[model samples]
Target: MNPKATRWAKSVAMVATILAVSSCDVLPRSGPTKREIYAGSVQREGDAFVIAVNDRVTRATAVIPALGFSDSFRNAGAVAADVIRPGDTLSLTIWENVDEGLLASEGVNFTSLDSVQVDGAGFIFVPYAGRIRAAGNSPEAIRRIITEKLQDQTPDPQVEVRREAGDGATVTLIGAIAGTGVYPIERPTLRLSGMLAAAGGVAVAPESAQITVIRGNQRSTIWFQDLFDDPRYDIALRNGDRILIEEDTRSFTVLGATGAQSVIDFESQTLSGIEAIAQAGGLQANAADPTGVFVFRNEAEEVAAQVLGRNDLIGAQRMVYVLDLTQPNGMFMARDFLIRDGDLLYVTEAPFTQWDKTIAALTGSLGSVNALSTLAGQ
Candidate 1:
């Protein structure tokens, strides 16, 4: 061979050797070892920080009377609606023979009498009495009005009114509760806890559930924890009052280089990335890559890749933040970065060291296949 061609061939051989050696170090020998990929792909999710079992969350407890009237009883006069519910028995009797005496029987057994139903129109049907407004009127007031109308035909007739079977009172329970339906309010006043207890309390996930009160089109949210904290928020439920329990949908999941991988729930409207990391029990000592910490999230079109280096964040307005485990001051910055739901955090390992084992395995497999083919051909 010519000297120049021989030199060129030697240079090519050197370059090929370098590339082959580098590939061996770069590619993992094992089929993409799970531990290696997990170390790089895992991230913290959600806003709220996770507390230890020994750590006590700030909570309040108060002793409330089991059956005492709530302060809302003062505004009872303002309520003007009523509805008959199950488990309540109402008795209806007519005075003398003015209206055919529906309730009065000498020997005949009657399944139904002249009982009035507070129907959809908020009125009750009485025999020969037509539709009379019974809703919003007390039992005594209804009796007085009926007596006045019958006074002309009967001489000093006695009128009897009693709730024998159905009391015109009901409460509706909706949202994040095990049983969401119309529950009967046996008594006049029902406390917030009493209603929850009647409906099997809040749903299984009480921490992520909220209660809403819908009365006369006015809606108000009541936090389960807050209801336990503040007595003022615990309201007295009235007839026809609706209690809705709403389940919280916002949450974050922590994976990869975190000490603990768990789904963290965010009750607040917003959560920071740094806060999410801390809630995940900080980063693992061996797997955490302080310089290569990144958050992989889906943007409008492409995946938004944000790098959080140790010195990148300086202000609070920026959503992305990098944490430095080596420095004490970085702890404060980690606390500042808010985490959002579905946000993924990845800590990359040092290059060349990651897939060395995988590449070696692949190369060995290729070499074995080539040798097997050569042998078979021979």
Candidate 2:
């Protein structure tokens, strides 16, 4: 080879080396490389703590978002339908066994008392029964008392008491329900689940359905499916309860070498790490580094301490949990691992993927160099 051609060959080799180094930065990759993430996680306190996921890590990080009712919500006893209270209107029918009965007209055998309102003092006035305690008693108890009191006034005075207006026994249902309105707490709709059924169930999917019970100043949210699986969550419905039904707000971000990259909503009550990846279409076959999957999350200090086996971490800690799919127990670990809300699932590109792109860039650069050498007639 000519001396000039040898020089040109050396120049081309140097230019290719430079291009390979610069190509990685300019390449259209999904996210950071495995080495880059490891480099960034070197400082454990200020930066993200890089922890390789295993059985211990999976157990430590398996925290699922809790859905439950507080003590005030569950302990609140239900209102009785039959018990008479203030603002309740009672209807009384008095019957006598004589031709001219007392308190009844000249020849009437029965006299119907309508719109008989119970006063704030829990007493209702009757013609012969006098002011009786109607608030704390049931309809039957009130009827028996009235019959006994009116027995002397008329011969065989048969009395009947019916609750006409029970305005106190009611609950309001709103949001993500087929029927969003106030429903009376009848015999059939006394419990939380029963009242939801009476309101036509939840409008959203069962997995995404969430019910928030606002009783007084205290409020609690629970998952819809928890009623059947966990009986303790289905609390008793009380009067003046405002129930708001809506969808669950839990999601995770999918990025890097996967089939698709986007924010995915949680589809079930609990989501495993592998299940979440599958929902995002799984890892990219040709370019994904199976051993370099990472889950980035902002873990609470308590959980972070448990995960790292150290109690020095404060407040919310940044964490990068690594998963190596090449290992024997990697799949099992991922299956047991749980993905939390706002977590980022990332898979680094294969080592050869960047190399392949670098070679393509170098190959293109060589063509232009060769053409320049030809024009110079070297």
Candidate 3:
């Protein structure tokens, strides 16, 4: 055989040998795809941390709606006006018929009554009326009572009454508010919006604000966005109500394979799963496994049991919620899925990426062998 042919044959044989050896450790074409991570033996059910595998349609229809609580308060009007209480200040003016001929004192046709504050016993002492129960009575009702009492002495007296500054209901504002103090409810129609306005508005943007109302023994929280989205959330304020405006520093962490991974603050009070992912710069198209998207959250014991489909009550469950973005309705379900504070969203690497990496390494060795063959042939 010719020397050149002999060399070419040896080089071809060497190349075949390298390829055969490399095939031993080569990545399997497709042993198990990314979907196996969700259904495979690695992540089976009955573990301490239950994995809830929910499709887009099931999550969007059932789980998403159950995540949020209903708004409890309603619009009852600001400064509950009909009820008067102790500590209220009242001002009165008295006038008698000047034309009456009876014991009407010449110099005293009109009297400017002294301003009175309702005592702890719910009574206010007027000069002639003396120890009137003013706490539960409206200003108009008080005026009538005073006028009727003074009619005999002053002759068909007319009385006018007005509540002083401390007479009406008020809401106390605190934390991240322009003016953090007690503000009087000036109108009967005053609402959460109006009360916030009276307090000089919020120090931060509404999207990043949380409003909490402390009424009696119960406390309720509402996102600033929800307050803006629905008029029904702008409920009326009551006396001694404490309105706390807090900056929403709550956030979630993104990990695994994504465009950006960090603990990101929610720009608004409430955020959907899709919005949260977008905030984190979305998933990396090349590295991310769309079927292996997972959200890790430590849910309440009862809620976790219900979500995990467990009958017995267990401890606080750390839930791993899986969503398959490869489906058509994935994005729609994500839009409805609410992301809470401290949630960890992870996009596992695609299974084929391993194969690609392995192949690239094999190709580099083949290139080196080809270069050596070319040198030998020369």
Candidate 4:
């Protein structure tokens, strides 16, 4: 070979060797690789506590969001529809055998007194039945009282009473429902589930729906599906109750060698690890290491103790859970494992990915060198 060509070859070989050796350490990546993570977390002075994922580990960490009803909410009883209240509008009709009746016209046998409203004192005044207590009594009981009082003036008189639109028997239905406004409590809609159905159900997915009942100073929330799954959740609604339905607001952060690196909202009340990965658009097949998936969280001291099987750890401890998809039970473990709020789910790059980057860097460096050599020769 020519001395010049030999010198050029030697220079190119030295440059390629340097580039290959430094590519992995200097190259920009989405996140740290598995080896880097292991090196950092394996030491006693490490910042995070890393645990291998398994059946027992999953059981220890499978926690659900806090959602349930208190006794004050679950035990709030209902009011009867027949019982009259202040501010109620009463419709009354009177009937008599005689053509000229006390409350009827000359030829008419029956007469209707339209919209006789109950006073704030819970009393209604009829033609002959003066100051009747219509608030505490049902319509049938009030009708009988009116008939007895009017019989002296108009013999064998009959009375009918009906209750309509009152401030006393209504509730406010708001948030993620089709019909959001004040609704009356009567007939078929006396319970929580019935009122929800009357409002056209939840506007979002059933799994993501959450219901809250606010009764004065007390407030309680539960999964919307739980109202039907458990009868105890479907407590009787009371007057002036405010019911709200909305989607859950919990989410997790996805990073590293996944198809997407972003914040993902939970799809349901109970979100599985596999479901969370799928929501992140899955792991990047070209660069992801199946055995290096990890979940990082700041667990409560009590939860940390349960997870580590040792009560010595104190305060809020940082935890990392590893999931190896290569094992036979790995997929099942992932399926059963639960993802929680504010968690970090990451997939590491394959070891070969670093080497590939090194090789590509060397080839690119050689290409530039060859072009420079040709220019010099010219």
Candidate 3 per-residue lDDT, tens place, 208-309, comes to: 777888888768777777777877888877787888888877889998778887899988656887888899898888877787777777777766656656
In lDDT terms, which candidate is top? Answer: 4
Residue-wise C-alpha lDDT for candidate 4, range 254-317, written one tens digit per residue: 9988888999998888888889889998888898999999999999898889988887886988
**Against the true structure, candidate 2 has what lDDT?**
0.85
Query: Best candidate per TM-score, number?
Result: 4
What are the lDDT scores of the predictions, listed in order? 0.52, 0.85, 0.70, 0.86
- Give Cα distance to truth, residue 228, candidate 2, Å: 1.7
CA deviation > 4 Å runs, candidate 4: 1-13, 42-44
* Residue-pair clashes per candidate: 37, 0, 0, 0
TM-score of each: 0.54, 0.85, 0.65, 0.92
Better of 2 and 3 by lDDT: 2
- Expressed as tens digits, the lDDT of each residue in 1-378 for candidate 2 is 577776777697667666665667777688899988988884733388899998888888888777799888777676677888776788988889998888778878889999898888889999767889999899999999998998877778888899864666678999999999988777678788889898899999998898899988888988898877887777888778899998988899999999879999999988988898899899888899999999999999999999988877779988999989889988988888899899999999999998887777677767766676666664
Clashing pairs in 3: none
Query: How displaced is residue 376 in candidate 4, in Å?
Result: 3.4
Give the per-residue lDDT of model 1 (tens digit) for 1-378: 566755565556555544665564454332223333334432544331212111011110011112222344324442322333333444566646434444445553222444554665556655544566665566677667667765665555566655533444667888778788887664433566777887788874666577777777666675576677777665666667888787766676665566776677775544555667767787666555554454443322111212322333333312222335445655444444445556565544434434444456556755665565445445
